[model samples]
Target: MTEAPATIMLNGKSRKIKQPCSATELLSELGWKPTQVVIEHNGQVIPRSETGAIMLREGDQVEIILPVAGG
Candidate 1:
């Protein structure tokens, strides 16, 4: 039997992933560099060191904040 895909809210948009993946995997899938943004998983801040072990679940809300440079 095939497992159901996991659905998560990314940057306020609904997204469906093939399977449950860690935050690190998610970033890589999105083509984002770990140092380019700050991650907030399920309303809590996720440190870079912990991202690799943090498994994203269905219905999880993720906020990726990117720094802007302007004067």
Candidate 2:
């Protein structure tokens, strides 16, 4: 049998990940560059330097916002 996926709330939507992973890894998997985005984990803002250290958990809430440039 395979391991059940972990579920987390991402940007108000539910998402399933294969396993628990660092916030950095999750961002990488989603094709996001840590330096270009802001991450909020469980209602706490995560600094870019700490992204690699924050491990994601099941039922956790995460919000990722990318910077927009307009002229």
Candidate 3:
């Protein structure tokens, strides 16, 4: 039997992703550049170096924050 897609809360919205994927893959899927945003997974800040190693699971809450540019 095939496994159901993983559903996660992304930026306060519900997003369904095919299977469990790494945070890096999630970023790519969303067309987001890792260097341009800060990732908070399950209420904890995830370091850029560990983004590739962290696996996204069903029901996980992810918050993506974009940095603001100022003059």
Estimate every model's Cα lDDT from 0 to 1. 0.88, 0.91, 0.90
Regions of candidate 2 where Cα sits further than 4 Å from its true position: 1-3
Per-residue lDDT tens digits of candidate 3, residues 1-71?
Answer: 66689999999999998775889999998899889888999999999988998898899999999878878
The residue pairs in collision within model 3 are: none
Model 3 weakest lDDT span, ten residues long: 17-26
In order of appearance, the predictions have TM-scores of 0.88, 0.86, 0.88
User: Residue 35 deviation, candidate 1, in Å?
Assistant: 1.7
Per-candidate clash tally: 0, 0, 0
The per-residue C-alpha lDDT of model 2 at residue 21 equals 83
Residue pairs clashing, model 1: none
lDDT (C-alpha) at residue 31 in model 3: 95
Off by over 4 Å in 3: none
lDDT, model 1, position 17: 78
Worst 10 residues of 1 by lDDT: 16-25
